[model samples]
Target: MKTKFFSLLVACLIVTSVFSQANLNDYKYVIVPTKYDFLKESNQYQLNALTQFLFNKYGFETLMEGDEYPEDLVRNRCLALRSNVTKDAGLFKTKLLITLKGCNDQVVFTSQLGESREKEYNKAYTEAIRNAFKSFEAVNYKYEPKAKDVMVATENTEVKNEVAKEIKKLKEEIQALKEEKKAEVIEVEETVVEVVKKAPVVKVQTKEVKNTKEKVDMKASTSVLYAQEIENGFQLVDSSPKVIYKIKKTSMKDVFLVISKNGTLSKKGSDWILEYYENDVLKQEVLNIKF
Candidate 1:
């Protein structure tokens, strides 16, 4: 009789322990909130309660809310997330999401299966959540101070003075560091200017811009003068010294030569704009102007 009683007690303890270490994979989502703990706002029918309480009860770790599981309730399992979605211009709607199986690797479960008896499903799911929380707590996160508690040290005037002296020494050292930085900055600026002066100046030939009237209605009432360039074979030449243009109507028909103040023919040039429109009738000439 004694042996039988001992075996029975051991079996009960084992069952309790097994339930306490329940994982999310071994359960299904509750389709409805159980009316078991109504007065407690924290025990709402949402996933938060399911996750939080389970985390609290079972000490579950490595499970994040809204993650590692689908958060939306299934369509058949869906209760309106929004009490009145029309109110506040559609702002008060709770997003209907499904809670997926955790660590089970199967996220999709039939919503119809859960809807048949949501209360029972929720009861089992809640139990699993509670177990998960228990597992989380089994591995607690508590910190112990590495240093001795400050209160244990008796107050002393000499110790206070020593700390104050060290602080004053640190301030003096900081002030010295600042002075050194200021001197270094001045030295760097002088060195930069000296380097610039020592560098050789290489002058590059600048190119001129050519302005031509667009054939369509996008033509703006603006005139531009640019430099004319001449290239040796395929090499590019940019030598812009002046440019000028006017919006007034001219008598050149469809051909307008942009005459530069330096007398370069705008229409007959091997330049960027003139060369591109070799077969086109020149509508306007961009002249270059120099001060």
Candidate 2:
């Protein structure tokens, strides 16, 4: 009888331990902000990037705050967990904690306190953050979204209803506009035909000129870049994934240039090179790019 009782006690304790350790797999994704509350600027000392890198290493899909939301998250924002790094001040030690919060702003899990005695801010913060992440390293992360969280489901339902109403209204408005446009087209058909015939030669020249100007403007506007993959070009961003430069591929093999921008970066026989106009003079620099 005592042996049976001991076995039962051990089973209960095992179950309790499993439940107490928050399973990160319950969350679909982790969102890391560009800046922590303790920092003034985005990616200051590259802490934000470090946080994102660690989360990604631990098998969690991460998204920056400025990034476009994935379809699943767009449909339900509560699907992802927001990551926060909080700092604890000590007289001779720097301490930090990594926390995950749900959409309702409730903290689901927090890492054990990480401490460092380094005098430098950057080194201390980096070491402390690394220590805190040790807690996450022990867990095997596998995505298992909590579909039955009642509060999250209710909030999502309310948002879905509102979006549905807005979409219906927009569709009705668009249908009305189409009908109005059709009537206008009929009224202007005869006039348009007469004008086309009279100004065919002049219109051809004007179109060529307009097309040239449009090409120039498009090239100029492409200078602004973001880390997000675009349809026709590539972008370079900082640790915060803020766009610093935009590059467009050229006809030459493995060569890319800044579209209408004052800089050009190209691969040159085992080395990457960058040339740009700065201070009304051309400047060149060697770049070390990882693929």
Name the best candidate (by lDDT): 2
For all predicted structures, in order, the TM-scores are 0.22, 0.46
lDDT of 1 by residue, 1-291 (tens): 999999999999666544433433233232223322322453444545454444334322322323333332231122111110000111322112223333334432211111111244345444434333333333333222112222322334457789999999999999999999999977865664464334221111011122343341112223433333332111112244232332211233222222322111223353212211223332223333221
**Which ten contiguous residues of candidate 2 have the minimum total lDDT?**
215-224
lDDT of each: 0.34, 0.73
Candidate 2 yields a Cα-based lDDT of: 0.73
Error of 2 at 218 (Å): 61
Query: Taking the tens digit of each residue's C-alpha lDDT, what string does model 2 give over 1-291?
Result: 999999999999666446534556677889999999988899999999999998898888999888998867886777799999999979999999999888889877778899999999999999999999887765666776575665666787899999999999999999999999999876666554454345333353356447644221111122322344565457776556576667765444665666545456667787666655544334455654543
For all candidates, the clash counts are 39, 0
